[model samples]
Target chain A: MVLRVLRSMIGLLLFVQVSVASAVLDIEIIGAGEHQIPIAIVPFGGDDLLAKTINAVVMGDLQRSGLFRPVDLAGKAPHELSEVSYPDWQARGADALVIGSVALQANGRIEARFRLLDVVKQAELSGQAVSANGDQVRAVGHRVADLIYEKLTGDKGVFGTRIAYVNRQGKKFSLIVADSDGYNEQTVLAQNEPIMSPAWSPDGSHLAYVSFETGHAVVYVQSLYTNQRTVLADFHGSNSAPAWSPDGKQMAVVLTRDGSSQIYLVRPDGSGLRRITFSGVIDTEPNFSPDGQSLLFTSDRGGTAQIYSVPAGGGTEQRVTFGEGNNFSPRYSPDGKGFVYTHFINGKFYIAVQDIQNGQVEILTAGGWEKKPSFAPNGKLILFASEARGRGILATVSSDGRVQQHMFTQSGDAREPVWGPHL
Target chain B: MKKLVICVLLVNLLAACASEKPKEVAAAAPETPAAKETVAAEPAAVAVDPLNDPANILAKRSVYFPFDVSAVQDADKPIVLAHGKYLNEHPSRKIRVEGNCDERGSNEYNLALGQRRAESVKKMLVLGGAKASQIETVSYGEEKPKATGHDEASWSQNRRSDIKY
Candidate 1:
């Protein structure tokens, strides 16, 4: 028993230190956003190296969004409002301009002060000082970008968010958490067995995912801070697809203990086990509504796999998808106005969204090996799994089906990509 | 020195008894000298388990299914039934049925379909006289595939269940 405890302690230590210094994913953006904002970000004045790093991060974030076109500065660098030259920017067709400065504080913290100016009006739109530890230079840059993006686009920026995905190379599978830009990749769990369906808790403090290390599919909730994990469900047969409620108190999981894949609700502590669906068929991938009053899932009880909605307390299930192909992996938009899912037709899967009120479906991708569509917290982009060059890669498309991005990992086939909530 | 001589005589007697009934000696020889003696016996007189014998039908362990279908087809029913009979006769043995799927549907959906395929085999095994406790079922979804190709030929090979002892 003492040896077992020591072995587990060693295992815990290995898990906590499992962060891999992997190459940042190569991203390809396609289809420019409608009405792209022409913005020029001037290099900050203080701390040349620090300013360059911050500017690079901020510029990369805006470019990847495909919603902004960078204006050429032509060697124009302004540190303050007094040094600003509005006529030149206007002549260069820049709608807005951004200027920032970074300084290393005596307390070992880095401070970045930035401002967004409406060039046509020659007035300041927004300005603020963002500060963080020296090690969190990227965080400060993301914050500055968020403020700029919100001020210009009138939408909350997601550059500060993170995403979770599973990287499978041969038989070795790892659950990874990385920044939304696919940098700072951290391996939450790495094992020889397969890991699937990682769902972030509502608070983003924990991740509930399915791991097969126990000889079967079992759901585990692991703390992102302590690297501690507890088995949320290990019932006989498969226990997978753990989706937390919006309130974070309860989670929905698919279990085969009583025969057939069915959805069940249980508290975060594994108590209050209750079966919600009685289809006696394949009913998996349960995602909660934003209000926590209902769940959207994929079921095949109607002779074909399609999306459906059922109340949180287990009542009549209403079909949500109809027409040509089958749909799977339905995730409600953040506003609960519509849902995004994978539409499988003609042996290909495409990410599609449907308006709940009008029931109008819009195909967001050209269609190929795409699956597991999920919405970003802001509902501006939908992340999904896609295949490129015969390897699984993470892909995202804007809600309007215009802007798309394909992010390819360096080593393994990245699958099951889920965008986390806004930080 | 006298005890060593007696021990040698006892070993010789045990070896003689093991050669006469290798099966009984092999069955009873757990951490005993007779187990090694039984291993030395002639192969012709020893009994081999059908599961390990390549020529036996029980050695054929896999059951295939059509896309999105869980029912065991007639072609693979015999293999599952053979394992069921083997498990019934050998009550001490237990087997696990691992289900797999092609790379077409969502991973979670494929996991459920794979599980249904495994459970379908388990149901047939129980019907063929194997006890429910003797069988365990698991689904690997599309995580494990026998063929990596994207065509139908490879997908058909991947949509299968393996009965492992």
Candidate 2:
């Protein structure tokens, strides 16, 4: 009977897979912590299949975080709170222990209950239960992971957030949205021409991106829920680089219709055109600050590409980056303290973050064609695009540069990653 | 005016042939008439259209630029000037200048750089006598590449401004 239930649950999960046979992005960690938290997640007992699935997910999430090291249980797992032997976990050098159980309710739903324990104190830190259908098991797992992460780190977990990126397979390009862990990937928009620079709306309901379907680069805003898209900036010349303001009321775009490419702000519905940057040289790639008072963008007016900031209402520009290397694609962090940008130096590109207050710079990733660094809503991880094995892949590094992870697709290149807002 | 000058030259040669025909008729009349007719048609068939001629500078449509540079080079200026002259002569003709860039750096910044490349060419065309209204400029940025390789050889070709009539 348990085997039958397991088969049915797996079948339901398979049915929920995206239409394309897209292999989930395989993640490889590098430069993880030297002193990781030693934790043990005992296998849950009831409804064996569901419990195992949830346990694996929670364990995987914590391990991928590079902060926790799950101890080898060797098949000895206690499911109930009373069954947990604190001495066993302490003997195994575990600082924390997680135990959970799943049971099939009478209404055909699965009820998952979990307890997070502090092995040192031999006391239960937190306990919770969640109910979900077979189709929602994966979501419940992510939620459980989120709860565990929050309880451990004192920060809200980003496991439940989504990411949007541009995937290139040969001549075809697609805008894909996937779970924060790179699972359940769905192609939101696919076309033969290039689709790039996907910026999620502040509310995470829509995406503003550049599409070349009309034979030239044009900006469009599309609703994720309704699949409806409106042409935001299809000017006479190239209309590219659409960035959303914090209020979601306006978008800043790069247009060449008026002689040279300049940054312009337009309403989401394509009205109220206002020019922002007045540089005669290239001024593009505009991103709004968290407060929407200033705009950060790349400009070559000083002869080399550098990041500059101008008031959102259009005013004198202030150079933000100064150094030997060129800086581009600046994105403001969630806290608005500083921004992360792609810096080119010594023939290689690296992701670097700058402090707005002190003008100090911290180089995050090592180097190599890294572009489009975006901060996760939690501001813990910075997602960017880098080449791996000669193919473009999405990668993330902890903001502190302690942990690094690379997410690779099976057959194509994935670039231009943007973390969606917390929904 | 060049076409009209060729037409006038052809007419003058025809008149000279006609005037000489009477004297030729005194020697051999039938052959002289056919020869005159052939001579009258020869120049018209051989006259070349400057725009379509391979030797004309206007035939060169692309202007290449150095890496990260949008200023039109001295060598490519003549090609732009030739097109400018042609556009000036044919006031009704319209041309579009499309700028492109090599695939490097930020894509949006490339768009602005490509536009600068195209506008630089457009500015020269205007200076060389073409009206601003007769010229339209657009930048494909790094999106449209003439060559797809990752090396300098391909990038040099990709960084260009193409004039299309």
Clashes of each: 0, 0
For residues A1-423, what per-residue lDDT tens digits would candidate 2 score against the true structure?
235334433433433233444455577888776668898988777888887778877877777677888898867788888888889888999999989888888887777888999999999988987666755666667778877888988877777678889888778888888777777677788889878789999988888999979766789998876678899998777888999999999899988777567899999999999988777668889999999999999988898999999999999899999989899999999999999999988778899999999999999988987888999888888899998888989988888888888888766888789998766
* Cα lDDT tens digits for candidate 1, B1-165: 322322232343344334443342133222323344434433221266545544344646788889889999865665666566667778888989999999888999999999999999999998766999999999999988889898999999999999989
Q: What stretches of model 1 exceed 4 Å from their correct place?
A: A1-20, B1-46
Highest DockQ scorer: 1
Whole-model lDDT for model 1 versus the true structure?
0.84
lDDT of 1 by residue, A288-333 (tens): 9999999999999988899999998899999989998888999999
Q: Evaluated with lDDT, which candidate comes out highest?
A: 1
Q: Is the docking of candidate 1 incorrect, acceptable, medium or high quality?
A: medium
